[model samples]
Target chain A: MNSRLIIANIIRWLILLLFQILILRNMSFYNMATPFVYVLFLLLLPFGIPNILLYLIAFGTGLTLDSFYDTLGVHTSACVALAFVRILFISVTVRDGSDEPEPTLGNMGFKWFLLYAVLCIFSHHITLFFLETFRLTEINYTLLRCALSSILTLFVVILIEFVFYNRKVR
Target chain B: MRNLWIFISRYNAFFFFIIFFTAGIILTVRNNIYQRSVTFNSTNQVVGDVYKNLNVLKKYINLGAVNDSLAAENAKLKTEILSIKNIDTTKETVVKDSAGIPQYTYLPARVIKNSITNRNNFITINKGKADGLSAGMPVISPIKGVVGYIQDVSEHLATIRSLLHKETYISVSIKKNNAVGSLIWGEGNFDYRKAQIKDIPNHFKLSLKDTVITSGFSSFPQGVLVGTVSNTGISAGENFKTIEINLFNDFSTLQYVYVIKDKYAQEQKELEAKLTNEQ
Candidate 1:
């Protein structure tokens, strides 16, 4: 189980890295679009991974992307914040369970999984974009960019999970 | 000791969170310093090459407008040629043979990508070092109105600092009287540029529809048209004047442009440098 999870985490990082560098970097609609796909690595970590490790992974993933994009550390700060919030998001989605791991998806019904996935993705994207556009002078345009990128990110993350996640078991 | 070890193991994730978060914040704060580690900046040769390819894709979309502007410029040039031919040299005291030709050379180029909505807007053009293009050269639309100045240059691509830039200052003058003023850009809309005509005598009585032209102080020649005054007025206590001139060029649809290279620029700059040192 340990080897399987580690390998899955590596694969998830690889996929997210490629999606960010190759497909999303050039995507634009009137200068308000740049897809933030690196959040996928943080969003899909197994529930059992230690929160410290999760935060470290999230921050590192974000920094790696920032290094390439010349954007400094906006992604890193926001991704770490998102990773810290994931546990609360999971708990809120699965209130009845006491000892059971906070399920990212399978244990929850389809409706709950969709809700949980969207909220986590949205939280990460919104914070990440907002912090990136910290210069208040450009608030209106930055808000537009954040909102559009968040919606697109939500659609992309779910589509990726549906295609790649195991269907037979939780 | 047992309790301490248990606490350490239980909250390891929390400790990791602090470490990663700190690293992230430090990186964000020192971004410019950290940017040295980046190998793929927009100015990098590889990135420049990639954008050059993207220019090809953009050209297709702008072809129609580009062709129209070219046609218009061609018609104007033909008329100019005819007028020059009909001139009787005996009646005109010509200083030199080159007076008829523009002292500034033009390199025709295409705008690959341009943005005007942003406060700090820039334009990417298809011509660069291979085409003798360099930064500091003036870029103008085919209609001969000012557009922007080249800011960056690669082997085959260059970026222009748009006229919309807040800091852009160009020396200009009133076309009719040669009244000199510095042209300054406003924050948002680039369709207009304000000219501050300092020390204009209160007696001149400036009015609306006054024509503004490029001052000879720049590499741009004296008569290159800028715009006409939308309004003019005296400031609260200032003796000089301030005039708001509506620009002739529409930045939104800029396609074809001519990059002007002043033939005497190098010698002029060297003379100015010498004059400054002597003082």
Candidate 2:
């Protein structure tokens, strides 16, 4: 509703998009290392951000990336699932009524935050590579891509949060 | 009613995410329609420009290697020219030039990017519509030998169906014995190819290091070197002989290429089409 919040959302989303397209895309190590930084947008959203707006933003971001990659909907599916499950991850990790200001990676401690982020990202990537491969014959490759991408994405998310945000609140 | 509306609104995000994810999976399943999206949704102007810039940068980086290759090819060509300098004969064939040579002209190009790890690998070439290149042209790496053939064409850009593609079949032959075979890459990696010599009847003593050349049955001309025989065996359950060829081209580092464009391709395609229809 506020202009500041809208601008913040736009800036954050744009940063994620650029990171996905320009940086992660070129770092395809061994063809299986697909780093996905778009999930960072979901991870960094305000703690009580409305779910509907979150879904819309996540869908738009993922679809846009899929368009660029020439993959029809792998990113879309993964992004949506990531967005939906992201809240569940936050709730499980953060204690209730602890006066937690927000749940950025810096606030949550890198190790704990990384574990949570990796789980969510891994789920998204597994689903994505599975659908892309479309058969059990490529199970090994699909699994490798999912794991490698998750590790790289986790590192990118933590690094971005550390660089941009103050680490005083959790 | 108010509570129900509140509940719906609260869970709307979850429903939306599920819907969108399902929609994405559906799109993935309907790969044909999704593949069509490439024509509309892809930002050609932006992607094309970026690719062009990268191609230019790559060309600059590979200048030394490219120059060396051109020099080597030039020396070889000069030797051939000197050998046949005195011969003067002319005969017209389907794809022959005015001097009775092949109508095809080779346009040297650099591969901007190539994907071989994927099931359907495609190579991007630097030359395109502006370079007298059209679809269905065959691309070969002069230094490493046969690479692949052109598949899709765009302005100032083209996609090559690399030899690693499953559907790709190339007409090839044994250069030493003139035994004909079909060169195909039905497995992983560009280092290897499966050559099926079905036309060659059994009883020929095929051995290792027998040279494989383009059979000139397809778009590729005669004597374009393919590879040497790595292994030969009878099909476990079939009568035909299958030869495994170790491809000379190192696809992992394909920097330069020659796009072969036959001047008579259109006429030949039309005649072949008519003949096929008649049959």
Candidate 3:
């Protein structure tokens, strides 16, 4: 909520959105395992950010991606769901009204961050792939996409954090 | 009232989440093309401009190869045009200008972004309204048969709802017998290669490698190769048989597609609308 934080987030948003839309948007491995690194923006949002603001930011981020992908509402819904789960997971694990540090790998340690990312990424991917497919008959295929994409996204997100944020934090 | 207000305020985040979630569902279910066109689709100026720049750079890098291919395609198209220029003069129902020239025109465009992984995949091309492209115009790959319909257009960019999309259904037929069926892509990109053709008659006796092409009954021109019949199933108790086709367009690496401009489309659409309204 400081000027520097706002500036940093705006820059982060632009970089992540560009990378996601331009690079990863078309990077699918045999129709499976598309890495959506933009979710890292939502994942790294500071812990003490207001819940309503988090939801709005998530919606905004997802909606921006929705337009580019031409999958209206699919990403929007997934981002909102991810935001909800992020809030829930943080509340359950972290203390109420704690310091507003971001839940990054460097700050929260590797193990804790991975679990948090798994839950939120799965939530978003499941909501996303299912909404995009919108059918029960292809549940298996949808589930496979969710699992594969979530794993890929998780890997990319972690790698990005290690490369980008580790040096900054140190 | 005070207690109720407190409880609601306590769960305000949940309420907001519900509002956004419902909005997303509405968009997903309705697949609101008009709404998206007016708003955030890449067709919009900002996103379109960015994509245009990125594509320019990518095209710049691939310019040498593209030039060679363009020359090859140019020679091929010129020859093809020469062959098709002399369509039988006696052919009835062909749309012609006052000077007897065919009305359908083809505009080549480069694909800036293509998605084969998503269930509702779309391809964005470098041409848009400025290039005389519009919604409902048929897009076909130069090598592959049908690509998709123009879903939205901006000044410099347009998004195509490709054959890989779940909502895109194309009317097609078996080339051998002209038996028609509907082609749809909802089987989860089994390999980003397969699509299902529904409503084929059980007695059609569809064999493997039976060529599937655009059924002229629809907006797309007739006899355009859709794919070859790869799999056929005769399920029990069902009057209609379903078959799977391997799409000719390798969406995984789709680079260029042509948007077909049919001069009679407006006239045909209006006439059909009138007929439907009357019925």
Candidate 4:
């Protein structure tokens, strides 16, 4: 709600979007593992942010990436779904009495963060790959892509957190 | 009214989610090669500019490989010209009418964007209406093999529905037996190296390495190389044989293509339409 927090969020948004489109867009490992580190922005958003704003931000992020990927609406739909269900993830991972402002590895323990990140990334990848292929005959291939991409994305997300935010504390 | 307002405000997030989710699905499913929505595809001005710049960088890195391919293509063309001269001396001319005019003209274009991973893959080229390119014109690779047909054209850009697209069905004939069938790219064909040919009767004697070529029944011209048979099988309870062919063109690394402009296409189309209407 503060001006400083809003400014920080805008800066984070721009940085993640640039890194995603410029760097990670063409970086695929062995033609299977594509790291989608932009989801880290959604994961780190403040828990107190309004659900409506969260969904809008998710839609905007996904649409921008979709334009770059030439995948019309697949990314947007998957991102919206992830953002909509993110509150459920936070409720399960965060203790009821805890007053964590933002969901970060430093604020939330590593174990909680891992579980949350895995769930979010898995859901996003599954929805995205399936929707992109959109055929029952290729279900196995779609599932394989989802699993591999989720792992790669999670690895990159954790690496970014450690390298950038490890020194900061709640 | 107060209670209804409270209910609406309470579930506003869910409502917004539904709205956006439906919109996304509509955008994803409704788009095709012919009618691309301008808002979120790479062909739009903003995304196209970014990709154009990126392609320039990639072009520099692949300069050596591209030069090698061009040299190979030149050698192939020289040999083809020599063989054609020999054929002209020994065999009768089969492709000429009384006027002796050629039926097709080729226009060269560079592929700016292409994809083989999606369910319905498309290729974007630098030529469009300004270069005399139009929809339904067949595109071939540098080696004179089938690539795709143009589906949409803008002022300076065009989109092609490649063979890897799930809905693409090409009329092809096996060279050895002259058995005609429809070639298609089925689901889960992620490799982009092969396609499936269906509806050939089992009675035909098919063998390994049989060549497939365009039958000239559709947009593409006759005798353009399609692929070679890699596998063959029979479907359950069906009298037709299923054939797998290794395509001649490596679609993954395609950089240049030629769009064939048929001078008589409009005339042929109108005559065919007239016949159908009379019947």
Query: Looking at model 4 chain B, which ten-residue stretch has the lowest summed lDDT?
Result: B32-41
Q: Which ten residues in a row have the lowest lDDT in candidate 1 chain B?
A: B34-43
Q: Name the candidate that leads on lDDT.
A: 3
* Global local distance difference test of model 2: 0.75
Chain A TM-scores, candidates in order: 0.84, 0.85, 0.94, 0.92
Model 1 TM-score, all chains together: 0.49
Which order, best to worst by lDDT?
Answer: 3, 4, 2, 1
Task: Please state the Cα-based DockQ of model 2 relative to the true two-chain complex.
Answer: 0.29
DockQ scores for all the models shown? 0.27, 0.29, 0.29, 0.25
- Which parts of model 1 are misplaced by more than 4 Å? A1-170, B1-64, B90-102, B187-203
- Which of the two candidates, 2 or 3, achieves a greater lDDT against the reference? 3
TM-scores for every candidate against the unseen true structure: 0.49, 0.49, 0.49, 0.51
Q: lDDT per model, in order?
A: 0.72, 0.75, 0.85, 0.84
Tell me the tens digit of each residue's lDDT in model 4 across B211-262: 9999988878888998899987656667887788899988887888999999
- What is the clash count of model 1? 1
